[model samples]
Target: MYYTIGEVANATGIAISTLRYYDREGMFPDMERSSGGIRVFSDKELGTLKVVECLKHAGMSIKDIKEFLGWCQEGDATLPQRRRMFHDRLAEVERQMDELRNTMNLLRYKCWYYDTAVAAGTEDAVRDLPDEDVPEDLRDYRI
Candidate 1:
């Protein structure tokens, strides 16, 4: 079934103007228009919107996504380029995950340090802890 622009915007959590912008950018190359030239989104358009959003969230630029879409239209001949692009995205995501993990580790260590200092009634107890005195898991995780 076809849905109006409002329904598509609501379902996709995208602003109507952004949808129009995506259309202007040729993001939805095959999306339909009604007799009145109103946008009418079908499941295909919805699925494509979801994909565009995912790629955007994953650090792919609109230009790269447009290129990716063009690659799709080129059929199996472009498969290697698409695969390489995704592999690059995966590496970047992995780097981001590692940075987050390090941040969490620092936060965890801070929590432990504060808890120890609070119990001792002063920061003195934890401020200059020796390497051997710190918890093994937190020893290397200080700020």
Candidate 2:
């Protein structure tokens, strides 16, 4: 099935201008144009746009995605390069997750500290908590 540029934008929830920008960026190599010179999107083109959105959201730069897509068009010869790109993205995502986890842990520890102090009606009580009284994982976060 074919869809107009507006229809593709509506279906993908991306702005029409952004779609036009992507097209201008050579992201739609297989795109077809009507006899009147109007661009029309096929389902396959829509699928490619979805992938571009995914890679964009995954923190890949447009230049990098373009390079990756170029590699894709080169067929089996680029398999190793594609694999390495994904592996690199995975490591970066994992690193981000770890940083977020650490942030959450610190927030949790702060919450517990404040709650304990409020319950005892004094910050002094929480401050003097013995090592054994604190959560094992939060011990390092004690301030």
Candidate 3:
């Protein structure tokens, strides 16, 4: 079904301006215009938007996304390129997952340490960690 920008935003949980920007950026499927120049989106456009959102969430940059869209415009000739893109994205995602898991583990250990310290009546246990003992970038992550 076709939907107005507002309806599409509600359905996709993306901002109306984001949808408009995606259209303007050519990351969206071909869009049709109303008699008065308003944009109308079809089911295909909505599906494409969903895929775009997923790609963005997976850490694909807008520049690469536009390049991917350009490859898409090339039709069957671009399948190999698309496959390579997905392969690269998969590796990147795996690396991010590992980093996230490590961060979560660090946070969990810190929480456990604080909990134990609070129960033991030694708040300083949590507070006395030396800066050198903690990671440089991670110092900002602590509460």
C-alpha lDDT values of all predictions: 0.91, 0.92, 0.83
TM-score of 1: 0.90
After TM-score superposition, the amount by which residue 72's alpha carbon in candidate 2 deviates from its true location, in angstroms, is 1.1
TM-score of each: 0.90, 0.83, 0.82
Using TM-score as the measure, the top candidate is 1
Worst 10 residues of 1 by lDDT: 134-143
**Alpha carbon lDDT of residue 59, candidate 2?**
91
lDDT of 2 by residue, 1-143 (tens): 99999998888899999999998999989899999988899988888898899889789999999999899899999999999998998899889899999899999999999999999999999898899999999988777
lDDT of 1 at 86: 89
Query: What are the candidates' C-alpha RMSDs?
Result: 1.6, 2.2, 5.7
Q: How many residue pairs clash in each candidate?
A: 0, 0, 0
Q: Local error of candidate 1 at 69, Å? A: 0.9
| Local accuracy of candidate 3 as per-residue lDDT tens digits, 15-110 | 988888888888765789899989999988877777788789999988888898889889999999999999999999999999998788778767
**Which has the higher lDDT value, candidate number 1 or candidate number 3?**
1
For lDDT, the strongest prediction is 2
Worst lDDT 10-window in candidate 2: 50-59
Model 2 collision count: 0
